[model samples]
Target: MRVASLMNVLGRGWLLAERALQVFHSTARETRALKFNYPKGTFEAWAYMTCMETVSAILSQVSQVTFEDMTSSLLLIRASLWEYGLKKLYKLGEICQLVPTSNAPDENQINRITSGITQQSAGGDSEDQGRLLVATLMSKQQFTSKYLELGEMVIGAFKHAGRKRTACSVGLDMAKFHVELGQIEEAERLLSDMCSLYSPENWTIFSANTISLLAE
Candidate 1:
């Protein structure tokens, strides 16, 4: 049936994203070890650049599907920032070593690199796909703002669809992201706002999770 086929396609996208995440994590660990041992050298620089490429691939794969998946979007944002940091290190190593300048990435270059993946997707909003592809190339400050904006949009979509609990859950996740970024006041305000949506008869888990996060 059409429903089964759609689910299969979605599941395939998620599976690819998940597998990419695993590879990225493993590559990151190896690169970290290389950095710790060599500090600043050709091998370390090479390892780091490779690791970043893997991270970029994960973002590319995720964007090939729906940007509506909060986990994939969050991971891409996090990995984007991490890539920024790693790139700085790579540049620093370039001064002392013949680091691979050819591998240096710019926004346009990354966009081109991911264009094939974006073209492969048969579903999801084109506008949202554009936003996600843009997100993968953004710097830390840019991605943080963009992601928060996306979280709000996704929450609105959930609310409009009468998925109040899902919306509240996403709001909590966004608040947690704020906390992770050390925006404590923003996190507190978000949690407070989300509280107004929860009641005794609904979203009980949201209240408990919000309270637990606030307590932290």
Candidate 2:
């Protein structure tokens, strides 16, 4: 019910934002009027996107959510963040510091997302990307779980960007993630999928640089 309520609230915010965009703009006298409601609405879609004050209130409620529900909510929140662009994200980071800011302003969205997930996950089995809120919400699952899912999403987008090998490499990383969790069987499955998606020969070559388990 909490998830549903949150979803409803998010949907209503989006609708209001859409209506705001249609709030009407015109040129009067010596001025041009333009209504850009969706922009703010997008950012406002999730109160916590920039709401440090309500973080406790909302998270207090979400803290009790199941891992499945919590991950779903987090995905929705992340989507809202992306809609606002990385520039705004960096700004939010300035305040809460939980949401990350892109240091390389020139990097594409996929790269930025990948870097965030990598930096956070590398710190240990943490899907929260080094943030207490994320860690708590996702505390039940293996830390690498959410990171892997997000990595795959980025890889899919990268494939459309014309870097097939780079895209496939993420799957290898997914396999590595599984290995770290001591899920050898799961890791092997991912590696096998990567080989089928890419090339057996290339997988063999790429296998050398990563952890030895891939070689096994």
Candidate 3:
């Protein structure tokens, strides 16, 4: 059947429908060519498997594309994961290892995201671009006064755009940075402001994780 039918039935289910469609298309082509013939349902099964492999490869590529999109969009979850890595590195006390490795956030990946943010910020139309820039900067271990100034710029854009969730996130990141710099009162004020503006569900997990760390 059509991919839309699969989507409607499954609700955000991409993998199964993609695989099935791939297999059906391949098998149908094979049948037309008469290059392969099998007993009754056997061909269909083989075709299904072939479709699955093809779809699996496509899905892998799709995932990478999606990751880049999320990074570009500065989605809170993606930013949180990056922040989590920073925390992990801090815990290991190998803060210098924040540079890209062959694994996560390798240097090339960092440069890509950084360049993406710079380009997006220069373009200056989307609130998401600003939020993403803040998230990316916050994920880094070291910051200069300029970075904090940039964080303020992000906060201003989020507020101007009426994005409470993004504003809260920027606030929370500033709070964490302030707390790390021994500016506890400023951090507390920012956290309090965030709590006032955002519901619990809207609070990013990174903020929750930071609270947990602080409580300990």
Candidate 4:
């Protein structure tokens, strides 16, 4: 359940979702009370279902969807960014957030995994469900802007459990996340302060040059 792998599944899931969208033409496809195995569903299952739901609900009445005839739906974009649920989907986000940064996959890896999917896409305005995938990849704190609060919680949890090593790894992940978003100074500060905490197995995979350049 690493972030990267989950995101890749989401990216692929969105591509598969396009097939479902082709079912309706010019009219919205309404799904009422679609009973899913809630909370019991695996992450992959939930992710795909969510992707399908969000896309269908957000852009309905497409006027047409001709998968065979790309020209048929001139207004339709093959790939797009969907901002579904806004900040409302917290439970799902929290479940994902608790996964340790050490185990979670970062966004860059997700991009690499989806590169082939992008190359094969049938030309759309943007990739479908891009933001949704990214949001899922976000740390719970980062996703919800509860960083300071989450930081304290994490520190307290790890310290109470006598897991100083685990604390360092989470801190490193926070630094790396900032780096991914181009927040170099913040990342560097975190890394430097927690330098002694880094073990051979836990430093971020991002290049030293990239880290150094950005930290400056």
Off by over 4 Å in 4: 1-36, 39-142, 198-216
Whole-model lDDT for model 4 versus the true structure? 0.41
As for candidate 4, its clashing pairs are 3-105, 26-63, 78-124, 79-126, 79-127, 80-126, 80-127, 80-128
In order of appearance, the predictions have TM-scores of 0.42, 0.34, 0.31, 0.29
Enumerate clash totals for all models, in the order shown. Answer: 0, 1, 3, 8
Predicted candidate 4 versus true structure: per-residue lDDT over 88-160, tens digit per residue = 2332343354233344534454444234334433322134543444444455445435433344445434544
Off by over 4 Å in 2: 1-142, 200-204, 207-215
- Per-residue lDDT of 38 in model 2: 32
Clashing pairs in 2: 125-143
Q: What lDDT tens digits, residue by residue, belong to model 3 across residues 143-197? A: 2353455456556545544566777777777777677667788777777767666
lDDT of 2 by residue, 52-136 (tens): 2222224444556653564443433333232222223333333322221223222233234334434534332133323533342
Expressed as tens digits, the lDDT of each residue in 111-134 for candidate 1 is: 443454355434443334444534
> Candidates 1 and 4: which is better by lDDT?
1
Residue 190 lDDT in candidate 3: 74
For each of the candidates, the C-alpha root-mean-square deviation to the true structure, in angstroms, is 12.3, 14.1, 17.1, 18.8
Worst 10 residues of 3 by lDDT: 93-102
Off by over 4 Å in 1: 1-132, 200-202
Ranked by TM-score from best down, the candidates are 1, 2, 3, 4
Q: Tell how far residue 101 is off in model 1, in angstroms.
A: 26
Error of 1 at 78 (Å): 25
What TM value does model 1 have? 0.42
